[model samples]
Target: MSVLDCGCGPGTITQGIAQIVAPGKVIGCDLEPGMVERAAALAEGANLDNLSFQVGNILDLPFEDNTFDAVLSCAVTEHLGEPVKAMSELGRVVKRGGVVGITRTDWAAHMIAPSCGAVNRFFELFESGFNLQGGTMNGGRNLPSMLGEAGLNVVDVLIALSGAYTPEPGNAMVNGWAEWIENLPLFDRVIEEGLTTRDELDAMCAEMREWGAQPGTIAATGGCRVVARKD
Candidate 1:
């Protein structure tokens, strides 16, 4: 099967799919040339002869109509101002009877244990900061509607929660959040936008770490994946 992975950053997932669809071709597309280069390098390192990478936009995919047997995108829609348009483009690239799959993180559904005013304030600031950056916090919950609107038949929906209960540095969710908080530019942006002060953000980060250490504490975020068929 010929497959296209839209918004495939570094081609991690695209490489995995290439392995699964051995002897079949897979193209990983991203908007950033650097990302394309990184993906291409990884594919070459993996010796994946059937895999390739290209720089392209989701809103206007570079592929011809009905060029792919399947299309897949992950963790991309929330950043898009016109998600439906991108979805339609995904649908357009798939051959009839082919499939399209998308997954998104629902930022609004994220929860931290031992709720308190400080924790609430932290999330409020996070949400506001994301919005100020032109992101949709609730994009995951709207996957089915978006796919349907794009003229695809929704075949399956999967929702899952992921987080860390212990203060394990290797835990992906924990590390991801920590890295985001520690990114100097993002931190500065939040402060510049008046979402919160540096001191308050630091306090919240410390509190979050403390909470992660507590017994039975969990910091979880929801994700949704939708599989659709172009009929």
Candidate 2:
């Protein structure tokens, strides 16, 4: 089957799908040229003939109508500036009876830690800015309706992958933040507001790690995995 993996970042899911498809083809498409290039390089390095990469956005895809047998998108809808139109675009490109699989992560708690009143306030301010200036951040709840409006026949709506997603501090997750915290823009953001001192933030980060490791303290996010067919 010819599958189109929309917003396929760094070939994470695309690489897995490529293994399953084997000789069949999968196209990993993303708006970021760098991501497309990296995905292409990874596929080539692995010598996987089933996978390829394209720099494109779902809001205005480069492919012809009825081209792909299945269209798959994950963790991408919330980033779009116009998700409703993007859903319609997905339907407009796929063939009749083609499947559209979707996955999401509604991570509100992650955006702001549940405890730490100061940290909570800090995250609220940070996220509020994103919400105000950023184009769109609608989770999957809004997408099912958008899919219906897009004229795709709803086949099944189910959970994609629902389980614990707590990021253990000092693990890969904390290091990721540690690396990103230096980003002048985000660093300046927290400091400008005087939300929390760097040392306190560091301690809070340690607390996040501790809480994430403890059983039952880490909360998992629920996501919707929708299966729709083009009529």
Candidate 3:
């Protein structure tokens, strides 16, 4: 079956999808030009003939209606400036029986205690941007409602829970919080906005690392997998 990867980044996932769907077509699209280029390189490196990467905004997908059999997005929906518009576009492009999936970090669930004062401020500001962009920290929280409103049926709702380990002085929960903040694209932005400082970020991460030394610190990704069928 054909597949579309919305908000695909660096084609790491695109290349994986290409491998999974050998002899079938797989297209990856992203809003960032840098990401599109990176995806193209990865796809080409893998020699994935069925894979293609494009740069396009989700709010206004540059594809015709009923053009895909399935669409998947990861760590992206929450970053969209217009998730509703983006969701509407996702629903509009796929044919009946086609499936759609979205995965994003659950910001609401992210906790960072014992952090540097600056990093704490940054975390708060960064989380706020999820709303500023018209999305949310927990993209899956309202998946059913959002998809239903967009004229799609909730075919399935799968929840995936995962844990990471730092194996040191830090505990899983503590390291998890540190990792989340360090991994955010908004961290720098927030810092620039005077929400926090680099020293704070480093201190927090160091503390987490120290705290995670035993058997490794761990972070659990309590994510939701939503399957929606086009009407």
In candidate 3, which residue ranges exceed 4 Å CA deviation? 110-125, 132-134, 166-185, 192-194
Candidate 2 residue-wise lDDT, 98-211, digit = tens: 988877554442432344343344344445434444433236566677788888877888754344444433234433444444443644556556754567656655555554
Looking at model 3, report the run of 10 residues with the lowest lDDT sum: 110-119
Whole-model lDDT, model 2: 0.69
* Cα error, candidate 2, residue 3 (Å): 0.4
Relative to the true structure, candidate 1 has a C-alpha RMSD (angstroms) of 2.3
How are the candidates ranked when ordered by lDDT, highest leading? 1, 3, 2
Candidate 1, residue 19: Cα displacement in angstroms equals: 0.3
Whose lDDT is higher: candidate 2's or candidate 3's?
Answer: 3
For residues 1-231, could you state the per-residue lDDT of candidate 1 as single tens digits? 999999999999999999999899999999999999998887776888899999999999888999999999998888777889999999999999999999988867876765645556655666676677777656698899999999999999998886766544333454355456767465678899776787887777766565555556667878899999999
* Residue 90, model 1, lDDT: 98
Most accurate candidate by lDDT: 1
CA lDDT of every candidate: 0.82, 0.69, 0.73
Query: Model 3 Cα displacement at 131 (Å)?
Result: 3.8
Candidate 1: Cα lDDT at 197: 85
Q: lDDT tens string, model 3, 170-227?
A: 5666555677677877667667767668787778788655645555334454566788
